[model samples]
Target chain A: MLTQTVRMLGRLGETVVKGVAEMGFAAVLLGEALFWLAMGRRREQPVRLAPIVAEMTEIGLRALPIVTVLAVTIGIMLAIQGIYTLRMFGAESQVVPGIAFSVVREFAPLITGILVAGRSGSALAARLGTMRINQEVDALQVMGISPVRFLVVPPLVAMLVMVPSLSLWSILVALGGAGVYVSSTLDMTFAAYARQCLEMLTLGDLAHGMGKSFIFAVLITLVGVVNGASVSGGAEGVGRMTTRSVVQAISAIVITDMIFVFLVTR
Target chain B: MNGVDRTSSRVAIEVRDLVTHYGERKILKGVSFDILEGEILVIMGGSGSGKSTLLNHLLGLLRPTSGAIRLLGVDITKAPPREMQALRRKMGVAFQGGALFSSMSVGDNIMLPLREHTRLDRKTMEIMARLKMEVVDLAGFENLMPAELSGGMIKRAALARAIVMDPKLLFCDEPSAGLDPVVASSIDDLILRLRDAMGMTIVVVTHELESAFKIADRILVLDKGEIIGLGSVDEIRNSASERIQNLLHRRTEEVELDADAYLRRLTGEE
Candidate 1:
């Protein structure tokens, strides 16, 4: 029994140390990428614009339909739940402010981030992992090009630009869904619903939500790129990293969202 | 078996007391050698003989456990990242599997190094890429993806990309590993032509004796993580070592297993 306890403690310590080392490496990679972006501009080696545009299309534009569907469903469900609870207190009209506030300030960005993390983050990790296995990353290195600059920067820039845009799109779709449901069932006009949504929303709320999405974007891309760059063992490695990228990205989004809520709300 | 005089020829690469380990097992054991300028040096070894490990070290892709590797007078084992990057620009590597970017056309693959390192106009880069394609006998196929190329065509295209920058040193790993005899010889011929035309020192790592003998100016034979012989093809051919003879004649090493140990292993007794 004593030996078992000691072995368990040893394993836990090893895992903790490994985790800390991995985090340190990831932070260094992120720092290097940012440094190159800041300094590469003055050197006339700015990140290429073409790949950024392509990645934005892949991560944001192509993701519209699914993000819209998920956001709308979430909005309708929240409205139903809010109405059920508010009707008990004779405050059914309060449901509008409640749904609009929650969707804009929290649900939309969080849900969109989670969905995009699952979709685009896994794709990026698998693609890069396959490239590493194929030795194309080594080829780039031999040619004097940093793989992080060539691969990570484009995705990083695209996520920063697109994730916030995607969150905003999700918020609009959710609001429209809630408005449509309230118009038919609750004695409210779509114009009134829109006005209430706009009235309940402050510039600070919009900025705060968008800021959370931006941070989520950075977290997802960093996780994916780090896992991808470290892949080995051929197809099995790629598959493992792809799964790991999604799990870690979603976990990071949730944890970051909690931290943002605590700080921004305070 | 006349050796090139170290005092007469300039050294392109000088490795001394090199040692490398993966986990607890040593991969390269204190190997030392010098590659002369403008000579084709072939590193020949059987499977698990550390040929690939040494190649990776020479390319500065892997750090040695203990040793020095000087490529064109730059101590790569201790060089900073920026210095290594600059050194990499002066050398080129053709990987075993071609390693082309699947997303890009062959033309873009060849033009990548130029676009990254040179300020040449797009038109000039295109012309240069085309010239390399012609030299590699893959003209007019640049717009096609790497997946569209045959085994031999892929090797040729990768070679074109490697030499497109006119690097001072070139490294080719298993250039003829998976090709037929005819195609393999053609690649060997192309390696010769590239060296003659570009005046670059080349290092090739291969287990194919015929290919090695055809293109090498000097041969280094490695066995079990150590260099057993280093000389011209004729010298290696006439070598009296039983290991070298076995390798040349394709004889498997004879092992006498202890019956007790074999039984224990079979039963997982260790």
Candidate 2:
């Protein structure tokens, strides 16, 4: 029993390490691709651009309402907690900066990315994974289409374009909701909270958070694509990989968020 | 077996010493066959005998480990993606489960390859889709989702999708595996009609002996990744090979009466 437990723990540790490594690799690959795009590696292909645009519209634009609503709700809940905790120390004014920084820098993007991971990322993984299992990937290959170009490239390009936009919207809604909370509960003026938000958050904070969002996007997309491409066996295999991708994506977002915080603080 | 395959044969697909593996288990073991143009080649085997694997290799769905696959005299093993695409445009495949895209309407599924591979406008694509649907006698069922259709309808829809590109070669895997006898036979008849009209080379993989005999221009029996027999239906029927005979004359699970004892009891002359 002791040996089994030890073995289980060892396996768990190895999986976590491997998961982190895969996430790092995915980020590096996306970063390299982004750099390539910057360096004019992306040639003019109007026909290929259409599908990527469609995917961006689907994964990014169509996802706004749900993401905004979820973020606002989280902001309200954070506002309540911020107010309650600040009141205990008689530091009600700090609640403004607290909610502002938390939402813009960490909470909004993290929560929104997690939500999208569970919703959109899982769907992408399942779609591609099932396609892989059902021989559709092979069918695509037989038809002389690279599954990577047809499937992976579209989603990767879409997520890279969408996540930051979604993150920005989430930040706006979260700040707006927190401002309402401040105006009502803390007896603070709306302008005062707005000014405080502007003063407390810097371009660096925005960049840091958006940077994390980009990483999250790449992580989710990569996990989805890799899990999908690696899919074999059958339905159960697809299911397993989809679950793994979503879980891995969300966990990576959290871990990377921590790393971002540590690096920014340092 | 020699240098030149019969030029008189009008070869459509020729696979030479095809070997394929799935992980550790070798699925196809140096299997080779050629399909003549405008003839139905029915591949028969028990479960896991690599019939489906061979079909996949022929269709270019799976790469062979070591073999030459020639389609219409072009070596597909070395064909570029564009060339393979051009080759695939001339062929169609109906998979085992009628793998119509679950996310699309039947009409959309039929029109997908056309839209992707051709520069046709939406109107022309729709017309083409409708024409294929009409050919499959599924004209009005275009708007139905795959999930909304019955098994036989799904099969017909899949067939419509396969032939929408006007393929010269139709590769169907287990065309009648899950359907009832009447529906299966109807599908078989449709295949025959399609072959007759299109002068298409049809390759069907099936273990259904009756279905095989019904539709086969020639049959190849596979066992343990080896071709046990390859001949016309009549040739297979008259084969003196014990394995072939045993397979053809399948013994039922129930006990049979003793012929001499029964005859003596009935007529007092054994």
Against the reference, the lDDT scores of all candidates come to 0.91, 0.81
Put down candidate 1 lDDT per residue, A1-266, tens digits, no spaces. Answer: 99789989999999999778878877987897897788876643567889999999999999999999999998888888888899999898889989988999899999999998999999999999999988899898888888888998899999998899999999999989888887777889989989988898899888888999999999989889888988999999999999999999999999989988998788
lDDT string for model 2 (A106-193, tens) is 9888987898788889989899888776666665554444455567777888888799889999999999988888798877898988
Error of 1 at B5 (Å): 7.0
* Per-prediction DockQ: 0.67, 0.21
Residue clash pairs of candidate 1: none
**What TM-score, computed on C-alpha atoms, does each candidate reach?**
0.95, 0.83
Question: Which ranges of candidate 1 are over 4 A from the true structure?
Answer: A1-11, A42-44, B1-7, B255-270
Runs in model 2 deviating more than 4 A are A1-62, A80-90, A132-138, A229-238, A263-266, B1-7, B249-270
